[model samples]
Target: MTHDSTGLRRLLLVVADGVRHDVLADEMDAGRTPALAALRARGSFHAVTSSFPSGTGPAYVPFLMGRHPARVGLPGLRWYDRARSLSWAPAQARSYAGIDIWHVDGDVHADVPTLLDLARPSLAGMSMLGRGAKHGRIGRSVAWMLRAAPSHFRGDLLGWRRVEQQATGAFLSRFAAVRPKVSVLAITSPDKFAHAYGSDSAPVRAAIGDLDAAVAQAQAIAVRDGWRDALHVWVVGDHGHAPVSQHDDLHGWLEAEGLRVLAHPRLHVRDPDVALMVGGNAMAHLYLSPGERTRRWWPTHAARWGATLDALLARPSVDLVATASSATTVEVRHATRGAAVVQRRESPTGPRWSYLTTTGDPLELGDSLHDLDAGTAWEATSATPYPDALVQLSWLATAPRAGDLIVSASPDWDLRARFEPVSHVSTHGALLRPQMLVPLLVDLPVTRPPHRTADVVPSALDLLGISCTTDFDGRSFLRGTPVSAAG
Candidate 1:
């Protein structure tokens, strides 16, 4: 595609949630998604493996910025900040006393340049459509720009198809009359359908069909309006989904293990023995503490607790174990601060576990147990000896502080203390391949192609003819080569 400075290519990014590659291929072969299949025939389509801990927020941010979660400082869906002594969940930022956690400096904006930033003067508009509460931040950012300049404005917050139809109709109506240099549209019906139903559910299939029709309609609008040559339509997804039979209630399990719940007086008044940390689909954090502890009883208690945890892992619901020693890196922040903790181990036998260490700590540093106050500093680490073993156990291991141990369970097994008959029927966030590997499909109208997620940024920059000075870990895949494509 040839372009001028003012007529540079218009990129449209459509995100479908939890749509897997295999599922798409199966659908295509069965003649389910005609629009997507047609696009594939004209260009190319393949499954691009997403980032680890393959959840929505972690996956999509990288695709937009062309970087990894770690590089963007969005390590996972939820992150615990040692300095701030707080646990940050992008999904729940709206509930955080009016604090917009998504805009926090290091979370989503560290090294990433959004498509809006890249489009610059040539950029006509950008839009994001999705269901999560976190998506509000994206809408807010777009609103901020629109308020600054009414003419340089085009955006939408069409969360679902109902809203999407209205918003898209408005966008197309306006753009068709006064065509801008570029206009971006994001459709999210496919992902929403997959989450409520399974990947193969009839409803999900119908949603995909609807989305395909939407794509066709949008393409037709572009073509008729003389914008087809300038428009580059791309369909992508944050992550794919798998059927989940079990879910782990980390909070309930911790409470049963004799941990004392702390109360954040300002946040909530209830005396919570364990804080149930929430992330998208799967994975949670458990913070615990006990009223009293001394150096004399620490080691014996830690070892005994670790053994009990290992025994618990032998259950069908349990899949892996990462002792404080195995899972994370620990660093003591201060003399008064506690020792760091990290530990993890995969289950080798039946109910085999794949213990992948997560990138963030799960506890909030400062909180109160009963009437006693405790340091908020903490870490995730292995169960090895430390210079100050007592402090390390207190900070990292769930046992020393809460009289309970934190456990990470597999998707098949629901970890609950009471073993309720009714719980979550479906879950995600295990260390399994299905849960960890997400799909990415990028359709760029160019001779050169990129294979890996890391390559996406440089490739995008190259498409825009921008200076490639950023030291991205991903390299661009050479164009016009079969091996360079994603599959």
Candidate 2:
């Protein structure tokens, strides 16, 4: 490994999930966050775009790998893999006998190489501290690397605040002793607060304040340790949030439309009375069954039945409509082949009811259509070629195998029904501005200007004075020659 004689440069990444820039600005104006305010004043700050589907899993994957979900093949958190006859959900594993997980679905792939391997060849030591159970794999991998080369690893699998403290302490202790060439510290508290409370809620503000304190601590350590001249600190978020209402009786509406609702027996739905299925934000996937009455008359009155469904969906709470084109099939996207039949009709109801069609089982909706087609005026939906579709409740009544139609409430309206109710008021993941745009602030010892998340990887590489061999979705904004240190 190459070493720099100038001293080591340190990097800190703090991921605050579901925090919006506007909310941060408001808090800063209110004087609730002096630490973040100081960083903003000393460094460059702007909202950088997150990945498609704007959820945590998708956003973090790209933030670490520097690649798009499509390129990495992880389009969303849950995906049905046809080849392996299995479905994949975040932090859950489903086995398909005699089939490789990657081969099951083309979309189940991870495209970019993680920082774990990239940082290995350059740094004197490296460590990764993860706050959530969902990041167990990352923590374990970092531990393994450290075990292999004791001189090159340091990390703790602790909660957000503790992890930040330990990581900052470790960097100070190490810099004072060996003065390693590079180090990274990541904090994950802001995201947790946003998920538990709405973005604008008091709890979120407090979380941001806590994160600011942690950053200030890290900055102090940098100065005291005399590494401030070469250090770089980066604050970024994986994705922002959107407000959504919770529904308790999602299945009740489906039952009213003449559909039988079933349960998974093992995985209990959070809201059993009304909800069949739920997504974090307003997006939901509902299952429908062609009950005795609907099935018997389905072929004869399919058109009229669809019209009735369209009318019911036209209600205030209801959004888009997609009816089944025929028995035994639902179409999630236009090119979504393999089904025996597909939903064909397309209509625009209004700004509220934008996209309408007779499609497939509610649970299988994909990200092919635009959200504006369903009546939303969000810039992310309006500008993108592919807008997310919101499924109507009545459409779930027509599926032969559907458990119940999944329904999504409006942005600020909670569905009073619950089938695994997810209550994040501010959602991001659609190519929308609120979800896609995130802030990147630099507070390193070096005089490098702050930049966006897209510049993260290159910035790290720049600290090491090495040109990246891989092509990145973003660029490096840090300007300076890298300093190397010998172990």
Model 2, position 376, has a per-residue lDDT of: 34
lDDT of 2 by residue, 110-164 (tens): 3445553455322211122121222122222444333333321121212343444
Candidate 2, which segments miss by more than 4 Å at Cα? 1-7, 29-32, 85-111, 121-188, 246-278, 284-410, 413-432, 444-455, 477-487
User: Over 4 Å off in model 1, which ranges?
Assistant: 1-7, 85-106, 121-160, 168-185, 261-276, 286-312, 321-426, 444-454, 478-487
Summarize candidate 1's per-residue lDDT along 191-290 as a digit string, tens digits: 5555445666775666666556656776787789776766555566565566656655554455566754331212242444334433444543333222
* Global Cα RMSD, each model: 12.8, 11.8
C-alpha lDDT values of all predictions: 0.43, 0.43
Q: How many backbone clashes does candidate 1 have?
A: 34
Error of 2 at 271 (Å): 22
